[model samples]
Target: MKKQPIHKIHIFGSVGSGKTTMAKNLSKVTGIPCYEIDNAVWIRNPSVDIRRTDQEIERNLQSIVQTNSWIIEGVHTKDWVNQSWQHADIIVFLNTSYFTRTLRIIKRFIKQKLGFEKANYQPTFRLFLNMFKWNKQFEKVDKVRFLQMTEMYEEKLIIINNRQDLNNWINNL
Candidate 1:
C-alpha cells in the first residue's frame, strides 16, 4: 500500500510511550523536522539538577511555533499546546499498553545514561516514574478529552492502542 504523505504531524501520548521515537521515525519517513518539548521546557540549574520550567517551556514552544514545518511530540497537550494542533495536518495519539511503555521507559533511561539514546542528559527515576502518572491519570483522562478535542477541530486524528497497529499505519497511512 502507498503510504499517505504527512505534512505537519503532532505526536502526543503518555511518557515512555514512544512519542519521541515514533515522531522521529515519521519525520524521517515523511521528511519533516522533529521537535522535542524537553528542549523547550528544561533548564539546567547547575546548583541543582536540570528542572523543567514553565517560562522556559513557553519560550521554547514559541520558538518552534515560529518554524514552518516540524513534528512536535510530547505528553502535554493542554490549551497551551493547542498551537500544535492548529498547524498540524495530523495528530497521533499513541495508546500503547502501560506495561510495554513502562519497559520502554526503563530501557530508554538506561540507554540514555549509557550513551545509547544520546539524550541531552540523563533523567532521574522520579521523572521516569512520572510516566506512570501519565498512564494512570493524564493520558487515561486525555484519551477521552482528545475525542472531544477532535470534535472541535477539523484535522486527521489517529489513535493506536498497540505498536503493530501503529506500525501498519506508519507504512500504510
Candidate 2:
C-alpha cells in the first residue's frame, strides 16, 4: 500500500506563528498553490485595505477549495472557515511559542516598514501594536475555541509546536 498525495491543506495559527512560511514551503515542495485567508477577507490596495463582503469571501473560498490542490493559511477560525476544513486533506495547527511569535512580529514589522518585505496592508504603529494584542487573544481565547471546533477533525489535524516537529512532518510527506 502507498500513501496518497495531499491535495488540500489548511494551516491555522496565531499571528507570526509561521503559518504562511509553512504553507509556502509545503506548496513549493508539493507544487500546490498557497493562499492567505486574509487575502480572501480583504481587498488589498496601495492606499487602504477594504473588507470583502461575507458572500464574496465565501464565494472566493469556495472557488479555491473547488480546485484540485491548494494550501490555505490563516488565523481565522470563524464559521466561514469551517467549509475549508471540510474539504481539506490535512489541517495544521502551528503552536509556536509566545516569545517566538512576539519576536517575529517585531521583526516582520521592521522589515515591512523598511520596504524589505511586502505587506497587503500598511504596517502602521497601531497595527503593529494590534498584532501583539491579537497574538494574546489567540492564545487566550481562539486557541481553545479552535481546539474545540477541530475535535471532529482530529484524524486529519496535525499540531506542530516547534521547528523540528514541522520539519519532521514535512520530510515524512
The sequence of per-residue lDDT tens digits that candidate 2 reaches over residues 31-84 is 999999999999988878899988899999999999999999999888889989
lDDT of 1 at 101: 77
Whole-model Cα lDDT per candidate?
A: 0.74, 0.93
Q: In candidate 2, residue 139 scores what lDDT?
A: 94
What is the TM-score (0 to 1) of candidate 2? 0.97
Worst 10 residues of 1 by lDDT: 44-53
| Model 1 spans > 4 angstroms off | 1-5, 44-59
| CA lDDT, candidate 1, residue 10 | 81
Whole-structure CA lDDT of model 1: 0.74
Residue lDDT tens for model 1, 93-171: 8887778877887888788767777665446677677756766775568767766776656447788889677878777
The residue pairs found clashing in candidate 1 are 4-173
Evaluate residue 166 in candidate 2 and report its C-alpha lDDT on the 0 to 100 scale.
88
| Residue 30 CA displacement from its true place in model 1, Å | 2.5
